[model samples]
Target: MPESPHPPELPARLLADPEMIGACRRRDFALVFRMVKKHAGIYPSMIARRCDLTPSRVGEVMAAKRKLLHMDVVERISDGLRIPGHLLGLSSRAWESPPELSAADWEPPSRPTEPPGAHSLPSHDVGDILASVACTSPRASTVQALRSSIEDYWRRDDQHGGEALRPAVIGQLRYVEILLMQSRGDTVRHGLLGVAAELARLTGWTHFDARQFSQARLYFGEALRFAKDIDDRQFMANVLACMSLQATYQDRPTDALALATAAQDHARAIKGTPRVLSMLSMREAFAHAVLGSRSGAHAAISEAHRQFERISDSDSDPAWVTYFNEYKLTVDTGIAHARLGEAEIAEPLIAQALHREGGTNQRGRAFHTFWLARTQLQQGKLEQACHTAVNALTPASAVASERVTGHLREFSRQLTPHRSEPAAVAYDSRLRQVLPAGVSGPPPP
Candidate 1:
């Protein structure tokens, strides 16, 4: 089949993938084809038609029965499929010639534009930074734009992982750091501090999701410092809560408890919205549950539920804390109960959120699915657990967060004892496809 006039273009994020780059470097077209099919939606037959090969040949190549080492065929795929020639180790393709070439005959080299959402400062930009610091103050509009970008980053992070946006965020954080030092007069600095605090906290979150513990803690501390400098108690409590969450994930439940307790205590002084208090109480509950303090955990959970009941339309929550709602509370409550060895109670709560969650947080859905599966499995419902666990892969497949990946891996480990069951076997077959290469499982022959 000949393709439509417009060929599919992989998103910049997918093209920037390290795995994709490695496959291209190794000339591993079978792997490359699989990745393209997975990410770009260009299947074997379409690939063959686009690259001027027989469908059977493309199938053979994908099945590893054939290889594409010939230069002419490689160039054909590059041009016909719009892959850059350099991606295949060849010289630049004809399409890459300035589109202006045919009409203008010649032209001077133009400034190269960075890929979308990317941020970096070249050596030449240092003077500009200093000049901006020395001359202009950040305007209200500029402050609003920064805040808006922070919100977008949060949404993007929730949908997937931090791999794609981390660079841009870190770049922005550095820029913010510079401004924080240079901007001195007026309420603008306070606003900038709040923004810096959030950006630093966000940067830390990206690292934490990737399992970079030390770096995560460092940024969390940096966030807290920025918050403290301005006496932003609510934001400080938020960062402490984040640190507590990280500690919980790192398996330091006692440390997590200390952090969460401190946050809860500090947040009380603000007597902020019920939503904020509910969130802190939940974080406290999580730590207590992890520490096996059933009484303490239950107490905190009760407080959280009570706070949730008091939430009103006019309640004011800091922008960052607005994501804490009844749905999230329910999910966390269930998870906390699970940690407390109450799977029977946990299962229903988790199942409700798993089915009712309306947001596009694929990673969150995957996390909930894993927890629900684990709870079901704990109750000896082997077949049901396997079915529920397998459903996680669909959502998990779309996100690259190490946290979600860790949940899937833990669920896999839990299923190890039942590996030979037919349901487990079925689940494993699909699971192996998405787990990163060189993970716990061996490479296929």
Candidate 2:
């Protein structure tokens, strides 16, 4: 067979134009200048001489002041720098056209404009009203809409009306897409690594959510591999923590302890921020607790508390790991306490976690609720335990997470003796709703 021929290189003009637009949009001057230098083969000093500006001034224009350039100035720069004006989308002829145009005119602006309603546009100007509403509306509305669409697709699958694999495959594809977007250009290495780390985390998480534990292990392993490849100590530590979480769910407490300890070691290897250290220590505490090691667990919890105490409100932390705050730390510490049979300490900590405003995501909240229910059961608050467990099952049912369902099964076993009670009956009904049909039996206590 003949060797495959190399792919054709993209035109410099085509590549540079998009980079210029992207840099302008993102306020990324360095990238804009670098692209100009690379594609145009013109030095800043040379452009400076022709444009009647100092080299440093030219640098500023390329980086920060590109937006400040008037159409005429841009034209002058393009001409003087030997860059085609058309490449910059600033040709004099294009701008000189009559204000009113036809379909054949230059491509219409890409931004969406409000279309007339069925009744047609009113005489009054409505642009201000629409602008005001757009400004006040949450930016997350877009994300929420996308999430809803995805859930709807999953709903179709749930009802046997769509491909069963659709949701999982789409989720995995989205994670990869985000990873690609975050990796391009001059993105900060640490920042890019964080994105890749998150992609892997979510890939694993979604599989874990779908109750595919073996598949989840594969994704989590890939994520840990990327985390290590980036040599980002903090990210690696976080990955280790996630590994421990997966192990715990799989009922391999020994593996959980080892992974959590590795996380602590990785965190210690670098001069990590307090936030990273707190997460590592918390995971360590959880691992030790699960393994029934009280002293080790308490010591890790104390270290986590100390580290958290040192974090100032204004400190700039990585977004992915910043969620590990005092509330979360307290919740994990409570888990440690619960495993150690310290009901008093565990109950209050778990309660505080539950009450705190938006301290966790949907999944985390479900897990915490499960734990609270378990603790309540242990403390003989059967009614309250059942209520909490049912509440946990409600959200847990929405997603196919084996981890959450496992907790439900455990709660069911605890409720078995009280099966005749109303609360236990309700709990059993909810558990049945979430579990697959014919799975058989309540979960082990």
Candidate 3:
């Protein structure tokens, strides 16, 4: 017989117990499932494959939607997990006895502070192996696979806008959700939830970038739930920070402030990574700017700078946060200043950021370019502003970003007062020609 990829990781005593096998045979699945998860370390997806059952059927059984009454099914379960057949009321001769367990081997590892509803599998570090006398369980290869896929999609989204990858991302998210439901063991489950949270956050951010507010909010809420389930305070703060950014763009300063404050509270409570802390603080600064609180905005911006400086090369950033760097901070700070009518201060910072990371990110370039043009116009450089603003339309036309469209529309409206001027008329006509058809009327401020 082929060896199972997910061999039982439980101690020999638990595998020999009739009660455990009886639970599986009788289909008290939740009890059996938890025992399998805690003791065997075998995920349900693995079990379904071994038993030649569909994943949905296995889920139904686990969830109590279906019963495990058939003798053939019971036999399959016993054979699949390599459970001793006699315990499942099969012939004793039909199965080989599993290895015996010593009294010392029966003791479960100590995890006194394991949070309720959040299980953590044993750490993969060699220290864990050397520290415990217990046999090593199979490492969760699936977790690493999921994490790789998530990171891949994230990089794709960064290079190309989400429109090309959003559907595929959503599909991957749905698959991850299934894995989450099927997952067993604390470490494995928590890892799955972490991946889910990151994917949810990415999906939300993509939708937000595309100007699909409702979908973005839905995914953000979904991400928040997963983060909360695992009590991942840092990731929760990340999701809230994203929510705050969406609110700021939607012109809901009060909502933006509330969400940013909530994110900061989480960051403080957890003493989060410096990068994450900096991001939350930056969001807070933007919120303050939107609310027209100059002193508050400056205070938050200074804090953001401090937090960003605290991020050292040795500090490891989580996959979701590696994108937050000095260039991003500069752009964010400049936008906050620009939003508050500080054109002179905003222009240089924005221009520097544009000269740095803006070329690689079309969406980022479009956003900053429009703001640079706005700052120029604010400083009464009408001709220069018109030309710079026109340059932004190149990316705006190519990308399916609502923020870019909104910026173009706003620039056109700002030029309306100077409509009779040759430069303004030419810029206005260029904006109209560059914008996608049917996007008429004023856009969100």
Number of the predicted model whose TM-score against the real structure is largest: 1
Ranking by lDDT: 1, 3, 2
How much is the lDDT of residue 37 in candidate 2?
68
For model 1, what is the error of residue 370's alpha carbon versus the real structure, in angstroms, after optimal superposition?
0.5
- Mind giving the per-residue lDDT tens digits that candidate 1 earns over 20-51? 87787667889988988898888898888888
* lDDT measured at residue 251 in model 3 versus the true structure, 0 to 100: 57
Sorted on TM-score, best first, the list reads 1, 3, 2
What is the lDDT, from 0 to 100, of the residue 242 in candidate 3? 88
Q: What is the C-alpha lDDT of each candidate?
A: 0.79, 0.61, 0.75
Model 3 / residue 291 / CA error / Å: 0.6
TM-scores, each model vs. reference: 0.69, 0.56, 0.66
Which scores better on lDDT, 1 or 2? 1
Off by over 4 Å in 1: 1-135, 440-445
Q: What C-alpha lDDT, on a 0 to 100 scale, does residue 321 get in candidate 3?
A: 81
Per-residue alpha-carbon lDDT of model 3 for 310-420, expressed as tens digits?
988887677678788899999999999999999999999998988887444677788889999999999999999999888887876776666676676667666766768
Q: How well does candidate 1 score on lDDT at residue 128?
A: 48
Clashes of each: 0, 1, 5
User: Which TM-score value belongs to model 3?
Assistant: 0.66
